[model samples]
Target chain A: MENKMGYNASFAEEVFRNVDSGDEIKMCMNCGVCAASCPLREHMDYPPRQIFSLIRAGKREEVLGSQSIMLCTSCYTCVVKCPRSIPVMDVMHGLAHYALKKGYTPRIEAARFGKEFWNQVYRRGRVDERDLAQRAYFAGGFWEGVKKILEFADVGIKLVLHRRMKLIPEKKIKGISTLRKMLDKAEMLDKGRSVQ
Target chain B: MADVQTTNQSILVVGGGMSGITSALEAAEAGYDVVLVEKNPYLGGRVAQLYQYFPKLCPPNCGLEINFRRMRQNSKIRFFTMAEVANISGSEGNYNVTIKLSPRYVNDKCTCCGKCSDACEAEIDNTFNFGMDKIKAAYLPHEFAFPMRYVIDPSIVETEDGKKCQEVCEYGAIELDMAESTFDLNVGAVVWAAGWNPYEAEKIDYYGFGEYPNVITNVMMERMASPNGPTQGKILRPSDGKEVKNIAFIQCAGSRDENHLPYCSGICCLASMKQATYVRERHPDCDISIFFIDIRALDRLEDFYTKVQEDEKIQFIKSKIANISEDEATGNLLLEGENTRTGEQLRMTFDMAVLATGMVPNKIDIAGAPEVAADEYGFVINDPEKAGIYGAGCVRRPTDVASSVADATSSAFKAIQSIARR
Candidate 1:
C-alpha cells in the first residue's frame, strides 16, 4: 500500500487557481446517494459516484471509454434530487461527447438512436418519421436496417395514405443559422474551449 | 387587567454560519436587539471554509470581513461563539431562550501572539483543516479568522503544558480554566439559520470512505483544494502522497436516495463539476471524470454544465457506483457497476475518489419552537406571508451562495415589514 501521507501542493494550488465556478469539484465522502438515486445505476459499469472519483483522479480516458456514460438518458432525476447538486447528467453528457469525438465506439443501442436523431435534426430542418426510421435503421447497421425494413413497410404505407410523409424533404427553416450557432456554441462549451 | 404580557423584544439568531450571520446582520441593522448564537468557536460558517466563492472573485474573508465589521459596529447584535440554544419557551415575537455557551480558554484581552500555541504541548486533528493536518491545542482557526484570536482545546491540552501556555503568554490571553455558561434572553422573533452538515459517508459502505485512504468527501476536497487547507491547496492521493493522475467525483453520495436524504441537496452536482474543472486547471496532464445519475442544472446552470463538459481533460460518466474497494498494494480505488444503456458490467481504477455528500438540516428536532416549521426533510419551512420568523439559505432549502444571499435579503425585507408593523 502507498504511504498515505504526502499531498501535491502545486497541484492543489493550481486547482485552487484555475478552478472556475463550474469547476467546484469536491471530495466524495463515500455516501451512496448518487448510486441509489441514479435511474441508470443498474446498467452502469461504474456508478455516478465512482465516475466522479475517476475524474478527480484524472482517469479521463478510461471514463470516456466506459459504456456507463452512453446509457444516460439525461432525465435529470439525479440532478433534481442530488443533495450535493453535482450535475450528474451534465457530467455524463460531457463525457459522452468526449468519448464520441475521441472515436470511442458506443456499446449501447440507445446511443445509435441518439446519433440518428442528431443527424436527422442536423441534415433536415424537421424530423420526419419515415426519414428518421430509415436513418435509424441504416445507422444501426445494414443487416439490422434491412431486417427492420419489412416491419416498417406497414407504417410507411399508412403514413403515405394519411399524407403525413414528406417525399422531397421540407424547406430549410430560416433560423438554421441561429440554431447552428447555438449548437456550435454548445459543442464548443462542451469541449471546454470557452467559458460561458 | 389584560393577561400579563412579557415583552421579549430580542431576536435570537442560531448557528452563526454565513446564513445565520446574514440573518443576524440584517435584523440587527434594522435596529432590533439581536442575540446571535453559534455552535462553533467562530462566527463564519461553511463560507469561511471555502478558499474562494463563485460568481465573484471575493474570498470568504472578504465578504466575512464586511459582516464582521458590521457585527462589531452594531451593538444591538450581541453574539456568543461556541454557544447553542439549550431550550426555548414562548412563541412568535415572545421567545424566552436559554443559551449554553462553551468555554473559550482564550479571552478578548489576548493579542494573536504565538506564545500560547508554542508553549502548549497538545496536538489534535484540526477540523478547520478538515483533519488533513494536525494543529496545536492553542491555535487560530484559520488565517484571517475573525476575532483574530487563538483558542486552546481543552480536550487535548496537557495539564503541565496548559500551565506553561498561560506563563508564556505575555498578554495573559490563555485561560486554562473556563466554564460553560448558560444565559437567558427574551426575543420577539427568531431566525433559525442553522446550516447543514455533510452527510456522513459511513452510512453508505459501498464507497468505502473510512475504509479507503484516498476516498474523501466533497467538503474534504474543498479543504484539500483550498489554499489555506492542510496541503496548502495540493491535490494528491492520501495513501501514497503521490501526485494524483486520475481523480473521480461521485455525486449525490448521500442524497437523492430513499434510504438516506430523498430530496436533492441542490449544490452537489455543480460543486462536483466545479471541482473537476479545478483539477483540470491545475494538472493539465491529469485526467478527471465525474459520475452522476443526472445533471440537474436549473435554468442558467445548464450553461455552466455545458462549459465544464467542454474541458477535454474532464470526462463524465452516467452511472451510479454500486461498489468500491481499495487495492491493497497500490492504494488505487476499484469500482464496479453496470452500464445501463449497453447492458454491460464494467470496472475501473483510480488514484483517488470523492463522494459528493448531501446536506442534512442541523435541527433534527426542537421542542417549544412551534413558531418555526420544518419540512419532511427537516429543512425550515418558509412562509412567504409570515413575518419575523424567517428561514434563509440552506435551512430553508438547498441553494448556492448567491441564492442563499438572496434568501437572506428577502428574509430581511420580511423582518423589516414585521418591525414596521410594530
Candidate 2:
C-alpha cells in the first residue's frame, strides 16, 4: 500500500485516460454514500468511497490490489443513489479489468472465474451451465476442485434433477462464428481505447 | 385597498420576505411609491420560521419586528398579504402587473382575539410549524404574524364548524364568504424577491426523512427549538417525546450534489453550528455531531466556526453521512458513514437526526411576466441590461439573512434608478 501523503496526479491521470469511466471519479466529493449504499461494503478491505479517496491520494498499488474492486456484483445501487451521478459500478468493474491487465491478481479465484466465464461465451455463443460450473470448480487444481465440488454436491444434484444442467456434452450455438467475430471486434476496440 | 394608487414611477416588489420587505421599505423610504405583495397571509417569509440567526444567535423576531414597524410607518409603501403577481406586461418604466389576492376570510376588523379559534372545532395542518402539529381551521399564521389577523382554511369555510367560528367573532371580522380577487398595478420597475423553499428532504430516499419519525430537516429543527414551535420549544424526540441526549446534524442533506441541489447552500454549515448551541443550551451535556463534507464558514464567519470547534461535546465529522436507519425499538436513529479524515467506518446511534437540507429557489412562473432568465438550477439570473426587471435575495442566489438584506437593498436602488431614468 503506497501511503505517501503528498498528492501525485500522475497515477490519477493515467487511470482517467486509461480506465473505463475512470474520469467520473473526479466528481466524487468523498461523501461515503456509495460505500454505505454498497451491500458488499463490509466484505471489502476498502469500500467503494474509500477506494476513490485512495485513488486521488495516489495510492495506486493499494487501489489496484484491493479485493474490493473485484467484489462488485453490479447491482448498481451505488450508481443510482450517487448524488454526483457517478457510474460507480462501471468504475469498479473497470478497475478490476485494468488490475488484471496490469498483472495484479487481487482475487485470483474471481479472475479465474471471470476468464472461464468469458471463454465459455467466446467458444460457445451461450454458457453451458454444467460445463461452466465444472470448469470454474477445477480452476484451483484437481484435488481442491474435487473438495469444492463435494461441498456443493447437493446443489449440483439439485441442478441436474431440476434440468437446469444437462448430463450430455454442450454444443455450440448455430451463430457461434458470428458471436466470436463480434467479440473479437470488441476486444480490438477495447485494446485501442476504453469502452464505457 | 383595491385602489392602490401606482404609476409609471412606482416600484412593484414581489414577495413579502425579508428581501421583499427591505426592497419595498428602502424604495419607499427614498420617497418612491412602492407596492409590496406576499403570497402568505403575512410577511416575514422563511425568516419568520427561524428560531434564531447564526453568529449572534439573536431571535429572528427582533429583525422582523423592526422591518414590520418600518413597513407600518412608511406611508409610501402600500403592502398586501395573500397576494401574488399573476402576470406582468409592458417593459421598463411602463409595466402593467395583475395581482391575484387570495381571500384572508377574516377582514381588517380582526382584533386577533382567540375566540374564533376557540369556537372552531375543525382542525387543519399548521403549515407554520411545517405540519408538525394541528391548529384550529381558523387561526393566526403565528403569534408574531404581521397584520395580527386570522385566516380561515378554505376547506372549513362551508362547514358548520366554520359557521360557529363566524358567530363567535364579536368583532364581526370573519368573512367566510370572502372571494378570491385580482387587481392591477402600474409600476416602473419589478423586483422579484420571491424567496426560497426548503429542498424536499423526502426525495433523498437514503436519508429516510419522511420514513423516520425522529428524522427532521434543519428548518423543522428551528421550529422544534422555537418557543412558539409544535413542541413548545422542547427538543424532544418525535416518536416518544423523550429529551434527546444525543443528536446528529447531517449537513448538506440535499445540497452540493449532482442529483440534488448542486450548489452549496452557503448557510447550512453555520446554521447547523448555530443549532448545536440550541441543543447544548437545553442540555449542557448532550452529545452533538455535525457530519459534513466540508465546513464552509467563509469570510468573517470563520470565527464562529472556531468558537464551535472549541466545544468538545460538539464534534465536527468530516464526512457526508451515507444514510440513516431508524431503530424501531427505541425510535433512535443509526447513522452510517465513514469519517473521511480517519478512513474509519461509523455506525453511531442518535436520539434524533436533523438533515441540514438546502434551499430551493421558489419558481418565478408568472404568466406574461417580463423575461427573467434563471440559471440551470432555477436561481433567477440578474441581467444588468434586462430593463427594469430584477431578481433579488434567495431568488437570485442562495444567501444568508444579512446578504439577502444587502441584495434586496441593491435591488431597491436599481429599481429607483430605473424609475429616475424614466
Candidate 3:
C-alpha cells in the first residue's frame, strides 16, 4: 500500500509537550511489544507501534482517522514492559482525546459508550447502570441496539446479581454542575479550541 | 619483600550462575583464590536454557566452554556443584564461610553414557528443560552442560531402585553410599549473583496461564523454540499438538505494575520479538500478533523490530489484554482487549498465547551475613556499606545478556578494588 502522509507540526509538538509523564518518545525502538501485548491490538486499524510511526512521520489525518488509537484499555502493560519505559498508553489515550476534539467520527461503539457515560455523569452526577445501558443502546442507533439486546440477558443477569441493576435513577448528587463544567472543558478540548 | 604488602586472600562466589561465573573468573584471574558454590549441579545458569543470545549468535556453550575450561585449569578457583553457602561470618578483608555440599551419588569417575538413565526407573521433571519434558533420576542437565557430568536427584531416586542403577553400571561411578558434607573456608570478599526466576504467572489470573494449555510463558516459548526442547523446536499448540497458525504474544504479563513488579524486566520485549522472528522463520504462514502498551526496542534493536514488522505475517497491536479465556473444544485462546485508538473493546482468537513474564530475584536465605537490601521489586540493592557485598546480573536489576555481563564485570572490578585496598 502507498503511504499517505500529512503533517501537523504544532499538534505533534503540543502532544509531546503536554504528556504528564517524563519520557522520551524518540527512544521508541518500535519492537511492537506494546502492540503485541495490547489486548485489543488485533481489532485496531493501526497497532500502537504503527500509530507512533505515523505520528512521527507527520501523518496526523491518518492517525486521527485510524480506529486503533481509540481502543486502548490503558492497562499499562506496554508502559511497564517498555525497555525505554515510554509512556505509550498515555500518549495513545492523549492522542485519542485529541482526535475526539476534531470533527472525526469515533467508531460507533466507543462514541455511543462515551456519550452514554457522559450523559449518566451529567444527569445523575454518577453512573446509573440501567439508565446508561438504555441511553447507550438507543444512542448507538437501532440495529446496534437490537444486536446488543440479543446478548443483554447474559450481561443483565450479572449486573443484577452485582446489585448494579438499578431502575430508579439516584437523586442528582452535588457534582452535576462541576461535571457539566468538566464536560464543557472536554468538549472545547475535543473541538481543538483552546481551554483556559 | 615489597613495602606494599598485597595479601593473598580467597573470595567466595555464591550461586554459579552467569554473574557468579563472571565474578569468580575475574577474581581468580586477578590472582585471588576463589570458591564458587552452586546449588544446581551445573554452572551457566539461565543462559544455558536459552537456544541463542540476542544481537550475537553465540550459543550458551560458546561463552560457558571457556569459563568451564578456565575453572578446570585454575587450581585457585575451587568450585562445588550442588553446594550451598550455609553460613557466612566476618567482614570484607576476612570472612569465614561454611558450605554444605549435597551428595551427587554419581562422582567424577562416571562417564556421561545413556546406561544410568536407562537403568533408573525414577523419572522427574527436568528443571533444566524448564519442566516441558521429563528426565530420568540419573540424567545430565543439558547438551553442552558445564562440568559435563550427570547427577542423581537423591530426592526422586528410590533407595531400592538406586542400588539397581549402581549394580548395572560397569564403571563404579555410582556411589549411592555418598553423604552430604560441609566445609569451612576463609575468603576476602563475596559476590552475590543469585540470578532470577520468572515471575509466577499464577498470580495473574486474567492471563489464564495455568488454566489454559495454550497460554504459556516466554521462557516456555524459549524451550519450545530450542532444538533440544520437548517439541524439538516446533511451535505447536500444547492443547492439540496442532501447528500454531495464529500466535499472540502478550508483553508485560506480570511486570511493570504497582500490584506486581513495578520495574520492567528489560529483555521481555526483545525476547518476544525474537520469538516472533523464530516463528516467522520456522513457519512462514504463521500469523503472529504482539499486543503491548509500547514497543520498547532500544538502540539498534529498533532495526530488528522494523525488520520483523516488514514481515507481513507479523502484526503489531497496541492494547493491554484484560482477559483471556479458552474455547473449550478447540482450545483456541479467546482474548478480550480494548483498542485504545478506536475506543472499541475487541475480542480475538489465537491458537496459542505467550505471556512475556518478567523476572523475580532468586530466593536465597543467606545466614550470618548482613541482610542484602532489595527493592520492592525484589532486585538486590548494591550499597557497599551494607556488608560490603555486591550484586551483578539480574540480581542487581533486570538486564539483557550484554548488560548482565557488563554488570558482572563492573561488579568484579569493584569487588577486586575492595579487596586490594584492604
Candidate 4:
C-alpha cells in the first residue's frame, strides 16, 4: 500500500507551466539509454532517466535537490542516441537553470566551477585559466584553497610548461565596452522575460 | 486468356515459415486452393530451426510437425520447396505469378537413405543451423525436414565426390543433369508472408560477430540449443567446443536506434529472455546476464519475464552494450557498457555472447516482384490497388510467433474474402 503513491502530475504540471522546455521530458520512455550513454553518470545521484522518473513521481524536493542535474557535460551522446529524441541535454540544462532560479544551491563541484567560469566570462570578454582556477580553488576558504591549489599544481605546472597559461593575467579583448553593453542588454532581456 | 485466368480463386502464400505455413493451412483448409512456396528445400521456415519458443518453452519442431501433418491431410494445399516467386504481374483478381524452382538435384523418388550423404565428401555450410555446422554435399535440410528429401549442393555437381554420391545412391535419386525450371500460375490473391531475415550482426561491426568466434547471434544460439543442431543441444562456445558457463545476451543489437533499424523490433527482448533458458538449462550453475536498454515483455508475456527474473541466477543489466572486444588470451568476449542503475562501467568477460539482433524484412533482397511495395526497412506494405496481395506476419510489421500466427489466420480470411468477391 505504501508503494502505491502513484505518479503525481502536479509537479510536472507546475514545471511545464513555469520553466521553459520542462515539458520536453514528457517524451522520456525511461529506456536508460541516456543514463548509460552519459560519461559523467557515475558522479550523478540520479541519472537522466531516473531524473525524469522522479519528476513523474512528483518527488519535487529530490529532483530539484539532486546534484545530477548540474553534472551534464553537454556531450550530446544521450541526445543523439535517445530512441524518442527527448532532447535530454536541453532538459538537464533547463533543470539546472530552474534549480538555481528557485534559489536551491546545488553546491556540487561542477556548479562551483560553472559559477566561477560564468562570472569571469561576464566580467571580461573571456576567461583566463589561471585566475579562474585561483578563484575556484580559494572559494572553499583558505586552508581548503591551499590544499586544492596544491592538488592541481601538477596540471598547472604542465600548462605553464606548455605555455598554455600566460605568466600574467589575460588582457581584455578589443571592444570591451561594446561586448559589455550587449551582455548587459541580453541579461536585462533574459531577466525580464523570465520574470514575465 | 486473362479472362480465363481471372476465374482461378487460388491463393499463393510465399515463404514457408510460420506465417506462410499458417496462412496456407488456414486458406487451404477453408476450401481455397493454396500454394506454399519456400526458397529452401523445407517447409518449416525459421521456426523449425529454433530449439524452443517463448511463453511456453515448447519445442518448435512439435508445432511444425503438427502443421505439416495438417497440411498433408488437406488435399487443397500444394507446396513446392526450393521455389521463389520470380515475378508477379496483373491486378488483384488476375495475378500471373512466375515461380522459379531451384533444382534440389536429388529427386523425391528415393526414400530417406543416408547413403548419398555418407558417400558425399564435399562439405557446405548448413544455413538452417545459421552456419554453426557443416552438412555433407548431399544432405537433408534437417532431421525434421517436411518432405524428408535430400538436396545436393549445386557447387559440387561436377566434382569427384558429387559423382561418387550419385554412383553410391542405389535408387538414382541424385540427378546431376537437373536444370532449374520456371513455371507460371494464375491466382486470385497472394499472401506476402515472405518473412524476415535477422539483421546481419556483422553490420553492427562493434559486436564483432564475424571477427570474434565466441560472439554469436540469438538465432545461432537457438540452433545450438536444438537437439538436432550443430552441438546437439549443448550450449558450447563455437571457438573451441568448451561448455558455456557464463554468457551474455546483448539486446537491441541493431534496433530502436537511428543508426540501424530505427524501429523497435518487438520480439528481440522476449526472444533473448527465452535464449537465456538455453544457457540455464544446459548448465544449472550457468551465470546468465542480459544487457538491455528496456525489457519490452508486453501483456501476459510479462509472466515469462517474471518467471525468468525470479530464477535468482539470471541478472538483468540496464544498459545497451556499447561495444565488445575479444579477450585474446582466453578467447572470451569482453562486453563494455555502463550499468545505469549502479553507474558501474562494466568490462565483463563471458564464455559466449549472443547479440539479439533485430529482424529485417526479407523483401530487401528480392525486390521488384510487381505490386509489392516496401517500406524503408523493406517490410512489404499493403497495396490497396493490388488489394489481393496482403502482407502477413513480419512482412507487414515486426511480430512474434503468436502475433504472426494471428496475422496469418486473419490474412487467410482477407485472401478468402478477396477471392470470394472475385
Candidate 5:
C-alpha cells in the first residue's frame, strides 16, 4: 500500500531502441489473445500480454526476469491470431535474446535447450543431432543429464537403429575453416550494428 | 413560349432494400415520379431476410407491409424487381438511364396460390432464409414479397416439371418463354442504396466457420431464430438437431482489425446483443456469453443493452475472440479468449458459436454507375459537388435499420433538389 507509483521509462526506451522487434509491442491493445492461446500460459510467471504491459509499466526486473518472454517456442499461433498484426512471436523471442545478452539466465529448461541448440549451430556448419542432443541433455550437469538421457534412451535407440543419427563424433563439413571465418565476420558485424 | 420545361423529373433508386424502398417512397410522396430497381426476384431485399429489427425488435414484415401498402396507393412510383441499372448517361437534371430486367417466369397473373410449389418437385436453396432451408423450383420470394409474385427458377423452365406446373395452374401465371429484357428511362437523379453483405467468415481461418458445422455467423443466427427459419426458431445446432443451451456470441468477427475491415462496423456490437435476445427468447435458462472488445450499445439502444444486462444468464466478457477450434470427440466448439476485467484466461467450450460478422458494403463497381466516391473502408462518400449521385444507407457508411431509413429520406431530399435544379 505504501509503494510509490513509478515506471522505468529508460527500460522501456532501451527495449524499443535496442531489442530486435521490441517496438512491435506498442501495438498491443491488451486483448489477451496470446495469453489465452498459449498452451504454456499456466506455467509462466506472466503471460505474453502481461509481459508487454510490464515492459510499459517500467517494471524492468519483472519484464527482463520473466520466464514467459523466454518460453516462446516460435509456434506462430500468437503471430497469426494478433488482430493488430503484431509479431508477438518475434517480440517474445527478441526479449529472450535481449535478456540473454543482459546476463539474465532463463528460469525455464526450454530456454536452455534453445541456447544449447544455438551453440551447436554456431560451432558447426550444420547440426549433428547427436552433438546437439548431448549438449541439450547435459545442460543441467552430470546427474540430471544422465537422467534425461536415460529418459530419452528408447527414442535415441530407435533413431540410431533407423540410421537417423550416427554414433560417430560427426565429421565437419568441407571447408570448415572458411565457414568459421564467415561466422566470425557475421558476429562482428552484428555486434557493431547496435553501437551506432 | 417564354417558359422552360424540365422533362427529366423522375428519381431512380437503386437497390430495393430498406433504404432504396424508403428513398423511392419519400421522393414519390413529395410529388416527384420515382423508379425503383432491384437485382433480386422480389423488392424487399435484405430487410426481408432479417427475422427482426433492433431497438423495438419488430419483425421486418410490419414495416415492409406498410411500405408495400404505400407503393400500392401511390401511382407516382413505379417499381421493378429482378432489374438492374445497366447504363447511365448525361447528368443531374437530365439523365438517360438503361434498366435491364431479369425474367421472373411467373407473370402478374400469379395469385400466390399453393398450387405451383405443390405441383413442382425440384427444390432449391431459399435465399430469403439465407439458404437455411429449401424451397420449391417455383416459390414465393418470401411471405411478404411486394407485387406478390412467384419466381420460377430458370433451371426448371425447360424441364417437364415446369410444363406440368404451368398446366396445373388455373391462373396461367407460369411463362416459360420469358426472356431478359432491357429498357431505357429518363431520370433527373439517382440514389444508390446498394446495401451491405455479411463479412465473409471463412477468411477468419482461426474461427473454423466452414470447418465446423455448429459454428454459424450472426446473420445465420438471425435466420435460425426466425419462425420460418431452418429449424423453425429452435436455435438448434446446425450439426445436429439438438437444442443449444450454451451459446457464445463473438463480436467484431471480421471488423475492427487490420487483417480484416479496419473500421468498427458501427452496428455489430448491438446486433450481437440483439442476437442474445434471439437465444434468450427460446431458451430462457440458456447461458449465453457475448465476447466483445467493448460494449458499443450506442444512444437509445443502450436501454435495450441494459435490459439484456439485467439477465443473469447472459454474461458479457471483454475480449475479442482470436481463435475457435472444434473438439472432434464432442462435436462442440472450443473458444479461447480472456476476461480482461478478471484477468482470467478463458478456454471455453460451447454447444454452438455465433460469429457476429460485420458488414461489407456492396460496391458500385459497375461500368455505368455514377462516379460516386468511396472512403478508405469502401463506404461510399457522397460528394456534394457530384450533382445527381448520392449514396444512402450502408453503402454510404455502415448503419443500423433506423438510420438507414432516415438516410434514405435525407438522400431523397438531395435527389429531389438535384432534379429540381433545372
Candidate 6:
C-alpha cells in the first residue's frame, strides 16, 4: 500500500455538522466493537467501525460510496454494545439518508426500495402491497420483472386467498392529502436541519 | 536539650502488601519506630501470588524474600497480621489510632505442622487460587506463608470440626475461643498503603468470565502459572485439565472504558505480556495472540515490548476483543472482533482466553482523619499540606511492584519528616 496523505479535517467537519450523531464518532477509539456487534457486518463492504475511520481520514468518496451505511437493519446491537455509547444505528441511517441527498446511490436496490416504500405511503396514506410489490419487482425491466413475479407467484396467491390483498383497485384513504402535507413539511424540516 | 516537645514519634503503616512492607522496612531501618498492620494473615498481598515479575521474569519472592529478611532482623518494627485500622484521631505529630485485630485462631506457639489440617473435616474454597480448588478448613494461607503458622478458619471454630482440629494440634496452637480485639497506638504519621483489588471480570459480562469454564482473569492466570497453583505448575484448561496449546489474551477487558474502569491501569499491558511468556516457556509450541487497543509498555519497559514483539509465535494484534463465547462440547473459547490495523473481521477459537482486567483501588475510610480527597475514579488523592496521612502504591494509582516500592520509600521519608518537623 502507498503511504497515505495527512488527515484532512474538512470532510470530518462537514460530517460533524451535517450528519446526525456524526459528532459522536469523535469518541470512537477504534476498538471495533461496533463492527463485531453488527449483525449485517458480513454483508457490508466496509463495517461501521471502518466507516467512522474513513470519515475521520477524509476519504469522502469511499465513505459516501460504501454500502455499509445503507445496509443497517436498525438492529440496535451496536448501539447497545458500544463502550462509548455512540448512537451507531442512528448514525448509519443518517448516513444512508445523507448519501441519497448528495446524489450518491451507493446501493441502488436499497435506494429504489426505500423510494417505492415512501411513494406508496405518500399516495395512498397506507401501503397497497400488490402495487408496491409490482413497482419493486418491475424496477429492473420487463423480463427480470416477469421472472421475479413468477418466483413469488405462489406467495402472491397465498396473500389474495388470505384476503391480505384486494383484486380491485383500492381508493385513497380518507385523509390522504393531509398526510401528504405533514410528510412534505417533515421533509422540508429535515432538509433545513442539514443546511444549518 | 533545645527541642520543642512533640507527642508520639512512631509511624503506622496500614497494609502489609509489597508497598506496606517497603514502607515499614524503610522507616524502621531509618531508626523510626513503625507498626505495620495487615488485613490478611500473611504479609505479601498480591505479589506473593504472582508466578514471576515482568521484564526479567524474576520470581516475585526474590524481592519479597529480601524484604522479609530485612523485616525479620529489624528490631524497631512491630507488625500485626489480620488487623485493620478502625479509627484515627489527632493531627500530624500525635495521632491516636485504634487497630482492630481479627483472630487467626492459631497463636505463635503453634508451628506449621500438617496434623491439624489432616484431622480437620471442614473444607473451604482456597481463595489464594481464586477458588479454583479447595483446602482444609484448618490450613496455612500458602506454602511460604509468613509467621510460618496455620490459620483455623473461623467458620470451623464454632463447629465439631473445630474440636477435631483443636485436639489434633500437638503444639496447642488452635485457639477455638479466640476473640476479636482492639488496641490503641499513638503514631506521628500514617502511611495508607492499602493496595488494590482486581476489577471484577464477571461484571463485563460479554467476556463470559463466570459463564465460561475456559475464560479466566489475568490475576487468575498468574496463579495458574505458579508452581503452587491449583494445577501445580501446569497451565491446563480449567474445564478438562488438558494442556493448552493455543491462548488468546484479551487486553483492556475492563480498563480505559467509560462503562468500566475509565483509566488505563499502568501495568496490565506489561503484565499480560509477561504472562504470555509464562505460557510460551511451559508449552514451547503454544501459540499466543494478545489482542489490545494499545501496547502501553511505556518507558524502559518498551524494550521488553520490542523483545516480545520479536517472537515469531507470539502475535501482537491491535484490536480490543469485543466478546467471547464458549464452545460447550470442546470447552474452547471463541473470540470475536475486527482487527483495526488490517480491518479483518476476526472470529478465532482458542483453548483458553485470559481477560486482562484492571485494578480497583481498595476503598480507604480513615474516620476523623484529615479530609482525604479522591479523583472521580476513586483513587486516593494525598494532600501534601496535610502531613498526617499518606496514600501510597496502588491506593494512589495503579502501578507495578517496582513503582510501588519506590512510592512506599517516598511515603516513609515524608512520614519521618512529619515527625521531625513536629
Which candidate achieves the best DockQ against the true structure? 2
Docking class of 2: medium
Model 3 spans with C-alpha error above 4 angstroms: A1-196, B1-8
How does residue B133 of candidate 2 score in lDDT? 96
Is candidate 5 or 6 superior in lDDT? 6
* Residues B166-248 of candidate 3: C-alpha lDDT, one tens digit per residue: 88788899888788888777767778888989999988877888889999999888788888888998998888899998999
DockQ (C-alpha based) per candidate is 0.04, 0.69, 0.06, 0.22, 0.60, 0.66
Worst 10 residues of 2 chain B by lDDT: B363-372
Q: Give the Cα lDDT of each candidate.
A: 0.74, 0.90, 0.78, 0.84, 0.85, 0.88
- Candidate 2 residue A80 Cα shift, in angstroms, is 1.4
Candidate 1 on B1-422: residue-level lDDT in tens? 11122246566778788888887888788777777878877878898887667634356788889889999899787777788888887655566777787878888887887888887777889998778889988889888777677888877445887888888989878777677778777677777788888999888776898889999998888788888888777888888888889988887787877657888888899888877766776677888888876778788878888988888888888666767888899999987654444434547799999999998877624566555667888887767555557777888888878887777767666665655555
* Accuracy of chain B in candidate 5 (TM-score): 0.96
TM-score for every candidate vs. truth? 0.67, 0.96, 0.70, 0.82, 0.91, 0.91
Q: Quality of candidate 6's docking, in CAPRI categories?
A: medium
Interface DockQ of candidate 3: 0.06
Tens-digit lDDT track of model 4 for B285-400: 99999998889988998998999899888999988787789988889988877676676666789999999999888762444555567687778776666578888999889888
Candidates 1 and 5 compared: the better one by TM-score is 5
Clashes of each: 89, 0, 37, 0, 1, 0
Q: List candidate 1 stretches off by more than 4 Å.
A: A1-196, B1-7, B156-158, B384-388, B416-422
Model 6 residue runs over 4 Å out of place are A1-7, A116-126, A135-148, A159-189, A192-196, B1-8, B89-91, B365-370, B385-387
Q: Model 5: residues >4 Å from true position, as ranges?
A: A1-11, A108-119, A128-167, A192-196, B1-7, B327-330
Worst 10 residues of 3 chain B by lDDT: B1-10
Could you tell me how far off, in angstroms, the CA of residue B201 lies in candidate 5 after the best superposition? 1.6
Report model 4's TM-score to 2 decimal places: 0.82
In candidate 4, the residue pairs with backbone N, CA or C atoms under 3 Å apart (3 or more residues apart, or in different chains) clash, namely none
Q: Residue by residue across B107-217, what tens digits does model 6's lDDT show? A: 888888789999999899999999999999999999888878899898998898999988988888888889998888888998999999999998898899999989999
How do the residues B1-422 of candidate 2 rate in per-residue lDDT, one tens digit apiece?
A: 47888899999999999999999999999999999999999899999999998778999999999989998898999999999888889988899999999988899899988898999888999999999999999899999999899999999899998899999999999998899999999999999998999999999888898899999999999999999999988899989999999999999999998888889998999999999999999888799999998899999999999999999999998878887888888898899887778877888999999999998998679766668778989988777778698888999888899999999999999999998897
